[model samples]
Target: MCRWLAYTGNPIHLEAVLFRAKHSLIDQSLHSRLGHTTTNGDGFGIGWYGHPTDIPFRYRCIQPAWSDRNLREAARAIRAPLFVAHVRAATGTPSQETNCHPFRYGRWLFAHNGLVRDYPAVRRDLMLAIAPELFPLIEGSTDSEVMFYLALTFGLERAPVAALERMVGFIEETGRKHGVGEPLNMTVCATDGEQIVAVRYSSEGQSRSLFHSTSFRHLRDLYPDDPRILAAGQNAFLVLSEPLVDLPGWWEAIPESTAVVARGGEIEQYPFTPELA
Candidate 1:
C-alpha cells in the first residue's frame, strides 16, 4: 500500500538514501519490487530531526514524489542523522497532502506500509477511542494517521513498543467484531529523534515487505575494500519497505509479528501479538 525508508547514522544529504541508492525511495515510488503495488504515486512525505530535542521537520504533498521540484531541491540540501521517507498509495481515501505519510507530532515522526482491512467500517470506533487531546490533531482521513494518533493516545512517548502492541491488538479485536477478514498488514516505523522502533505484523500472518540494513561497519568488514561503505558511520543503519540495493548481506527481513528497536549502534528485537484490550 506504500513504500518507506528510515535511516539513522551519518548526517548525509537526504539524497544519499532518498535518491542515490540503487533502488532508492524515489525509485521505489515507481519501481517497487516488494510492495503490494509497483507504483506508489498517490502522495509522499519526508520527516527528519534537526536536533535531538527539536520537533522533526516534515514535508508532505499530494503530488507524486518524483514530480515534486521542491522535494528534489530540498533532498539535496537537507541532511540529518535520522529520518523517514514514505510514498503512499492511498487505499480508498482521498489523495491529499495531509493524507501523506511520515506524520509528525511533537518530536516523533511516523509512517506505515499497510492498512487496516475494512478501515471505513471501523474508522468511527477507532477514532472514538483516541484521547480527546489527540482527536483534534488528526489532519487526514487515512488509516495511517489514525494509527499514528492511536499510538500517541496509548502512550507512545513513554512506552513505544507496548503502546503499538496495544494499538494493533485493539485493531484486531475491533476488526473481528466487525467481521472484517485479514485485519491488518502493517510494517510501521517511528522515531522520536533519538531512537527508532519498527514493527511488522499482519492478522493473516504474511505481512507487506520490510527490511533493515546491516551496520556500515559489518558491511565494510565483509567487503573490506568497498569504498561506499567507508563513507558511512560504523552505526549507520537503514530500515526500508524494500532493500535499497541488491547487495547480499546488506539487509535482513524483520520477522512477522515482531518489533525492532534501534538506538545508536545497538538493535534489539521483540515478539509481537495482534490481540488488545
Candidate 2:
C-alpha cells in the first residue's frame, strides 16, 4: 500500500537516498513500480536519529513529497547514521499528520507497509488486546500504529521478534474469529537505535516487496573508479520497498515470510512465521 526505505551504516546527506537514487522514495510516492498502488501520495514522513540519543528529529506532512519544497531543502541538510523514510497510500485511513509513519516511542522507531484487512471490523478487538499501559501511546487510528503499540505492550524493547510474532499472531487470530482470512500482510521495520530488524510476511504467504542493498564495501569496490562511492560510510546498508538502482549486484530480494536483521556489520535472514498457539 506504500513505499519506504531504511538506511544504516552511512552518515551521508539525506538527499543521496531520498532524491539522488534512480528510483528514490520521493519518485515512488508519485510513481511506484512495486507497490500495489502506483501512487503513494496520501502522506509522507522521514525520521532520523541525531547525535543525542534522547530525541530524534521527524518531519511529517499530509502533502505529497514531490509537492513540498521545504522538505526538499531539509533533505539536503539533515544527515544521520540511521534513518527511515516512508511514503504512504491510505487504506481508507484519514490523511492526517498523526497517521504518518515512523512512529516513535522512547529511542525506538517503527514503520509498516501493509494492511490488516478489514481493520475496522477487528479494530476494537485489537485495541483491547493491547495492555492498558501502552494503549494511550497510540495517537493515530491506522492499523500500522496499532501494530506498533501492540509490539510495545507485548515487550518490543525486551524482545523484538517475539513481540512482533505476538502481534501478528494476535491479529490473525482476532481476524479469523470474525471470519477474516489472511488478514495480515506485514513488511515492518523496527529499531531501538542499537539494532534494526525488518520482517516480510503475510498469512497468505505472498507479502509486500522488499529488498536490501549490497554491502557498501562491495559496491565501493565494484565502482572503485567512482569517487562518489567513497562518500558512503563503512557499514552503510539500505532496506527498501523497491530497488533504488538497477545495479545487478547491488540488491537482493528479501524472501517471502522472512525476518532480516542488520546490525554490527552483519546482515542475516531467517524464515518468519507467527505461532499464535
Candidate 3:
C-alpha cells in the first residue's frame, strides 16, 4: 500500500500540498496513519502539467520522500495548475525508480494506492492483454504500471472511467482464474492534464481510504486564518489517499466503491463497478 495526492486548481507551489500541509504527503511517506505500512520509504514520484506543453513533467526516484533533498528543492521551486505525487511502499515488487507512482504516458498521469493480489499468477495474462503497441510503454514490474497500460490498451484516452473499469475487470477476471480469492484493492487517480478521475474500489469491497477537499473558496472561508487555503485558487480541488489536514468540513471521505470526477471546479460522484468487458 502507499499514499498519494492529486491537486488540480490554481497554480501553486508544489510544496504547499506536498510538504506544507498539516499532514503533507511527505509526512505520510514517513508516518502514514491509514496505509498498510507506517513508512512508505521505497520510493516517491511527482508529475505536474506546466505551461507550453500539455504533457506533464515528472520527477521520480527510488528515494524516500522525507529525506530526498532534490525533492525538497523541486517542490519549493515548481508550480503548476495540476500535479500528482506518490510515496511507495512496495507491495510485492522491488523498489526501483521506474516502479514509482504517478506513471505517465503522453499527456496522462496516474498513481495507485493498492495492489492486484496474486499479481505474479496473473501477470502474464494481464501483460498479454495489453495492446502490443502500448506494451513497450510499460517500464516497470509493479501491478500499478501494468494496470495503467491495461487502461491505455482499453481506450483510456477516449473514456477514462470505462477504460479503468475494464482494466480492473480484466485483473479481477484473470486473478480468479488463478485461484486468487480477492483480486483488486485500489484507490487510483488518473489525469489527462484537464479532467481528473479517481476511483476507490476493490473486488472484495474493502477499498483503501480516500478523501477529497471541498472547493478552495469554501475552505478559505472555513479556515479564514489559514494561509495555505488563502493561497490556493478559488476553484482548486484536492483528492488524496488521506486528509492532508484535520480541518473540519474541509475534507470529505469518498465512499467506498465510488468514482469521483473533478473538473472545472465541479466534483461528481458515481457508484463504481467493474465493466468486465
Q: What is the C-alpha lDDT of each candidate?
A: 0.89, 0.87, 0.90
Off by over 4 Å in 1: none
- Model 1 over residues 3-95: C-alpha lDDT tens digits? 998888878789987888888899999998998898999999999888878999999999999899999999999988888999999899999
Candidate 2 local Cα displacement, residue 253, angstroms: 0.2
State the weakest 10-residue window (summed lDDT) of model 2.
225-234
- Tens-digit per-residue lDDT, 1-277, candidate 2: 8999888765778988899888888999988998899999988999888753646678999998889898899999997888899999999899999999889988888999999999999999999988897888889899999999888888888978888888899999999999997889989999876668899999999999999877878888787775545776657778999988787788989999888888866888887878672
Instruction: Tell me how many clashing residue pairs each candidate has.
Output: 1, 2, 0
lDDT of 3 by residue, 151-239 (tens): 99999999889999999898988998999989999999999988889999998888899999887787777778877777677888899
Regions of candidate 2 where Cα sits further than 4 Å from its true position? none
Candidate 3 Cα outliers beyond 4 Å, as residue runs: none
Q: Return the top candidate by lDDT.
A: 3
Which 10-residue window of candidate 3 scores lowest in summed lDDT? Answer: 226-235
Ranking by lDDT: 3, 1, 2
